[model samples]
Target: METIPSSDFFIQFWGVRGSIPTPGKDTVRYGGNTSCIEMHVGGKRLIFDGGTGLRVLGKSLLKQGPVEAHMFFTHYHWDHIQGVPFFTPAFREGNCFHIHGALPADASSMKQHFCERVLHSNSPVPLEGMHADLNFYELICGETFKLDDITIETRPLNHPNGAMGYRVTWQGHSVFYCTDTEHLPDRLDENVLHLAREAEVLIYDAMYTDEEYSNPKSPKYGWGHSTWQEGVKVAQAAGVKRLAVFHHEPNHSDDFLDNVAIQVQEACPGAFLAHEGMIVSVV
Candidate 1:
């Protein structure tokens, strides 16, 4: 129901699943690729995460040719960074990409993680094998920086090994991307709420149901995932214009997502499940 100018701002979901890629008949409708999102804001090409979906996005970018873009990673988890080696654009000589994120404890810098992931023992093609002009920036949590015409604000997320949540603003419109985060019971995350405050869209982690998260026999409290219920609460508390529930659980089929959507809509009319190839205008 919300819209942005056709020429300036749009967000597209290339993948929406969490934890793992589950490509099959059951996930076909919503998609099976893990955590990649593309945004075109003020003519800047920005990508979030590099999950398996990035492979598909890379193929599309190849057809366009001579691509230049900035990619922001939430974390270096396998499900989030596994597609880097398969991204065709990274293999192209003329393409340029800047990788941005907070450095993991195990890695000295963002570039180091990229290198290690593509090492001889880990991946067939080493980091040197990629012909693209790649650059990496290690950012601190709670830092504010600029990329082209967009202003980006980063916050630390409550995930193992740490993740960063980003808020990108341009031309008075803002969208917050927060995934792989766990929420504390009965309280909104001050960091997430700060980044999401009054934003046009809040694309958040809704990887579990409240019931599943609270299951006594199998509690997932510290597993670094949040529920749709928590997402709705944050949206309401932050006064977000829309809530795009993202980073779905791998086992949650289309029917399961539909039911979750219904529940979200009933509690907050602006909330909806994020689906692959879905475009959102953030104006």
Candidate 2:
């Protein structure tokens, strides 16, 4: 694993968009790639999801030579796993990746899902062509595990085919990655609250606006996505320090997001919209 000194904790957003990749002039400011994020904590490299942004992140990692990281996936959705085939580091000789994810709803292991399902349809070469030391670790929702000095907790989320949320804590700071989850109408999600309670940062799925979510013309209810307004509620209820409004709606253009940013700031004074290439430090 690539190591860093000190007790620094950082979260970098490689992709912030949700659903699908939207590359165009209108989305240049926020981002075009689907969900991927990187976390550096306690001298360890941690990655969340394998969206298209992972490919871009891979290119940057090449400058650092051979590397190792712990990769975690929320679900096997196409938008989340499409970057696996293009992640350049995975095809390199000396690189290593310890992949982790909750088992598929079906009777398959993490390796089977990634190698057979994800890679089979996307990659041009077989696993043999990828020279990296790849290791897959199966995870269960609501389970807690220790990664060296880091403590990670996983919980189930409300999403189609189910998705998992992760809470990473090291030293005393914590960061919750809770994307692709839908909020309950009657009450806030208790599962999300448990992982995000009093945390330094909560990276949430805010893929629609209240207006967009409930629009009679195109209702987003039960779509496994939440609005930024709901994200603020979760933050306040959990006593979270900062809320990162992530998982941008694919069709939301830069100008559209710029408007949402203002609304988010107004609703939650401490919260801000998450954007591509944005990095937040958890202190």
Candidate 3:
């Protein structure tokens, strides 16, 4: 098994669920962690989001010794930034991290968001205790940057309070990380298609089913989430080679997801739901 994450290009899902952590017998198969994903490309480690799942990924990284990584945030939602306090690697002295994210629409700097909200003074874990060499970078949506030979692109996502999608391409292979975004009711998102166009892998936000999203009694409209059904549509339109359905609904159990997974395959044979510990290779 390819256990180590040093592949030329690959992704590992440490936490796959959305909104909140759902731990219990019912959620075992699909896992309950929220939002963290790790990707290794061109000899650099890149992470997306810092949900509860990041704590687990941190533990694993400890065994690999001193660390250097780049972490990106899609938005400042509680579930997405809640795991920073528990990430062991961030507290270790010799490690380094370059954190990246756009300023929230409210104009709060990423640093202020982390210090004031995530690592609050009231919390037991203080920012003072984290000894890692943390570097903060301002990432603007619609901008493109390069890390050596790797090209990273960003796009604005349709979400409340705003979120950003990322497209990383290296050696002609690409992976799209599009989460916490909703689809247009009538047309495919041009920005989403631009990033996913013929990409090797696409990890998308599929936090609700169409039925639940439109449930008359419990509607999820304006929830800033998309359905697996919409994911299929985007993948097909973008000619994505494989689709990884992500950001699972918290209320969904393993069995519920199993049924959904089956349906996903029926709709798009190569598509599968993202799960804790699931790994996908892009090149």
Candidate 4:
């Protein structure tokens, strides 16, 4: 048996965008942030992804002082890793960061995905100079690992760039994070469903609307993302207790995302949208 948090394990979203950051008037309510999430378990803090949301989360973490951090990256897509250089902790020598990610299918190594100047070289910011003690690991699908009391499982996602989804479990409760995945023949897979089955919460990619994603003219079928309806279907099929619609489309306005949330609730009964600062506790 694993040791669990002291009755206070929680997960919080710091960023929730699909492809890029879209901060502006229309996105303020639901937030146009990118993909970063924080987990607090057994007094340990683990960060998932380092998208634009890391800029803000980094500031908050700086104020909180030195602490160990484990960062999990779904993939090396720009939107998922561009904010690592902006994370304040990376500049502090006292901080240590363990970064875990999925290696590109054809790439020689995972580092090849993020180390080229063609990606972030034009900008003044670069990840190479970060002062923190950094360690990187590549995770394989079906492999299980531990952090504090939590057990984690990874699976490849149906994405053009080969992204991955994660399932984190603690205290016998689970939360599955599936961002930036496209629906293949079906939106959900039995392997993924099994990983998420009876989960306390399932945070999923909800970057398009059924009408937008399924329409012949608008379908982003090859784009590696899904609509709210697809997310609901996956959650229901997985037997998740609650569903969190995450990775909102950059163009989806607050009102638009809100309506999607309502519709997801209508479909799944206990569904909600994942905002920049929302914290969820699962017993």
lDDT of each: 0.88, 0.90, 0.90, 0.79
Clashing pairs in 4: none
Model 2 lDDT per residue over 219-262, tens place: 99889999999999999999999999999988899999999999
Compared with the true structure, model 3 gives a TM-score of: 0.96
> Model 1 over residues 153-218: C-alpha lDDT tens digits?
999999987899999999889999999899987678999999999999999999999999999999
Model 4 TM-score is 0.91
Q: Which ten residues in a row have the lowest lDDT in candidate 4?
A: 1-10
Query: Model 3 over residues 161-182: C-alpha lDDT tens digits?
Result: 8999999999999999999899
What are the root-mean-square deviations of the candidates from the true structure over C-alphas?
Answer: 2.3, 2.6, 1.5, 3.9
- After superposition, the stretches of candidate 4 with alpha carbons farther than 4 Å from their true spots are 1-7, 105-120
**Per-residue CA lDDT of candidate 4, range 1-283, in tens?**
1233355567888888878899889988777779998877666677888888988888888876676788888777778876776777887888888778776666665556555521366646666677778777778866888876888988878787687788888878888888778776644676567677889988888888889987996667788887788777878787899988888888888988878877787888988998877778776
Off by over 4 Å in 1: 1-5, 118-120
Task: Using TM-score as the measure, name the better of candidate 3 and candidate 4.
Answer: 3
